[model samples]
Target: MQYRTNPDYWNQWYPSDLISESFPGQFRNWFYSLLVMATVLDNSPPFKANFTYGTLVAEDGRAMHKSWGNSIEFNKAADKMGVDVMRWMYCNHKSENNLFFGYNRADEVRRQFLLPLWNAYKFLVNYAILDDWTPNGETLPILDNVLDTWIISRLNQVIDKVNTLIQNYDPFNATLVVESFINDLTNWYIRRSRRRFWRSEQDNDKKHAYAVLYHVITTLTRLLAPITPFVTEVMYQNLVHSNNPPQHIPFEGEGQGVMSHESVHHCEYPKADLSLVNDDILDQMSVARQVCSLGLSARNQAGLKVRQPLSKILVHMGDYHTELKPEFVQIILDELNVKQFEIVSKVESLVAYQVLPNNKILGPKFGRQFPKIRQALVVADHAEIVKKVNNGESISLDIDGESVVIYPDEVVIQTKPIEGLAVGADKHMTVGIDTIITDELATEGMSRELVRHIQALRKEAGFNIEDRITVYYQTDGDIANVFDTWTDYIKEETLTNELVSGTHAEEIFTKSVKIGKHEVMFGLKKI
Candidate 1:
């Protein structure tokens, strides 16, 4: 087969060197051999040839040889840290970014993100089995609470996002969506509902929580199956079998009562129901998030932490707020840690100067009169000019022994600010910050900072969430009085039974010193 397609055979058929060697078969064979030689000789065959060859020939070429030392062997990496971990690393990577195969980054990924994810899954399963959880694949119950509905809604949302991203070859966004779901599950859903999972003997709420989480894990494993095959399979086998065992035999009753291994890889992926994804809701949330980020950034610039409560945030919108306002209001309030938000119309308070055109359009019609028109417009009262412009009438000006009319459309109008508000503006938008920080606001801010410190101390003490503690403070003047009044806040935040105010040294396990005109001390104990 090789000889028949060689240039020598073609040479005999055509009886000419150029015509024979230039034939399709000879050319193709020559290209293939050239490629093989390039790989075999260099010992560092370019893996990038896959991309370059597709560009040149508009088709996929064969994989480069392992002899070239460029072939990626998955088995070795998989051996080090399971096939699922490797699969997760590969599938989560963006297609546009070049993926360099090595041990270090892979090890880092496994240690940091992958292992934690696996541990979280394991934790869920352990508790779930102890509770004797099961999913009947039917409409079990409808949740009346907002949090429950929100989580289920969020799950469907992730499904929609993942499906769209994967279908469009945007694995980066898909990975981010998956990461967000995991975060919500671990941080928000599980953390908030931990007690429900640990409840004793046949509690209905506990059962509901188990059912909800079980459904979530099952769906999550199915979703992760494409990305992390081996781990997901193991997780599925353990979790699924514990609840419901398979009935069919693998190969003609090859095994006894022992269940056969089912590959999670073969499991079908979930299709996103577009009807479930509310774009209006998403857009509202998106705007709220944007506002929240901007507000947070603003707070950071002002050296204020997110735990501190703000009086209010004023969001200015031009026509878009009608659609986006209702959805984003609560989100913005929560994210900014504000007591309330005041929506105000007329963004002119936030806006400063607007730039007008340089009379380029009017210059053609009025010629020398353009300069006179510009002068008149510049000198005219803004309100009067605006009125004339709104009425669709042109301003008349005389220059160089000629009179000419200037249309409003020929020039631009801009707003210039004068006093009070701290204003920042661009061509299309503006933002203003109210700088009147009162003593009450300052006390509230200080209280919030104290809350943050207490939360940090709780984490550092290695105390379980249910543990009780007593807080101690060492500060003077307003700072001391602020903590005294907000002692209830401290007790609640730290899960403390009581708060002791003063420079008491006996109960101190950890000390946090805020460098300022004052100093504060706090202590915790597990009860």
Candidate 2:
């Protein structure tokens, strides 16, 4: 179909920039035919690039079969797993791998990725409405606040990456990068920024925090619009204030809502705000996040819940070069709920290396003598074995008078925490927790626990987030003593006007809850 011969019909869509379809079958069918027709007509291909996607299979790597009860009807899957979940699962996966789509996988996608994103949105919207914070302008705000700077920098970086990935049709990695940003946004940024939002004064810092998050989320909606049309449309409409937004959206007041745009699809794909990018903050935050991760791991290793405060953390930056500033160190300490932290060069005082056989990979290969091989590995020099495994060397072992070789992949180098101090290590760094909890530390942990209960009570009492309530407690012994000792701390956290000693009004909400080993009755009354 030459456009020169029949201009009216042929010029409508003569050459597409790209074509995408399922692999081999498309190559044999429509793809082959389209190229043939285009070549015969004008000596060219119809599209500049061709993308082929892989097939879907059951989770067990078998074809979908009704007889085997391994198949899912489209409507059933869509209705149960949700269209957004299915789309996320598809987008998050590499196009060349067989996608094992099922309820289980979809549930994981919802829990692992979508849940955090949704929580962040919910947190922002709830707090925004509580404080009556609305997007004032479209420009990204530059702030001197460490968290504000770091998150904005991250937002710009993702904008650039997602734009590039989308242009190249690399949706898998693009979604992955977005998910990582979401994790940082919810877990790190928003968690750290909560106090800024909760402060009594409506300060410039608070406004900038909301603005940065608003920009990040709305821009993300625009970027995700193509892939998740329904959710993104809903999110954009609900999140952004628009005068003419649909009735169902979360729009309350009208100013510059939606910037006169009706839908997210109408908005321009977000461009990276290069002016906001700070490589230094990004690098520092990266190390900070990884350090927090290892610190949490150490806490888990020590059977210590985050609610139980630890004394300190000892971090060894094995190869990482970023120097933790005071603020960055403060973030790690606050996040991990540790008192102090020290940077050390050697982690031997915190962790011990041991070589363990990967039973799964070696089990089938050395079936009968696997136990003997394991025994040999157990008696081997731990440090030397770790060195060999790390360097990709194989170890020779004697089992029943026969020499057996253990390859690097057949073993795992494990870092065990020291007996009293729990430690977690990875390639980049090692973090060890001070497992010794002093009386003061335990009391502080108790205070944090009380804060949790007070927040829950506020919610249970149908009180608004900004509502200040006087707290009443009736307890004896340590529970009562903790309340008296940390009265100001509790009041500061729960927005209490007063910490009363007795019960509340007969009509107000009161609940007796367990703290540690004893029960304490708590009452709340709105003022």
Per-candidate Cα RMSD to the true structure, in Å, reads 11.3, 6.3
Model 2, span 313-372: residue lDDT tens: 899887688898899999988899888989887767677877778999888998988888
The TM-score between candidate 1 and the true structure equals: 0.61
| Candidate-wise lDDT, in order | 0.59, 0.82
Model 2: weakest 10-residue lDDT segment is 247-256
Candidate 1 residue runs with Cα over 4 Å from true position: 1-85, 92-98, 102-154, 157-217, 231-268, 273-275, 319-328, 354-433, 502-508
- The C-alpha TM-scores of every prediction are 0.61, 0.81
Among the numbered candidates, top lDDT falls to: 2
lDDT of 1: 0.59
Cα deviation of 189, candidate 2, in Å = 1.1
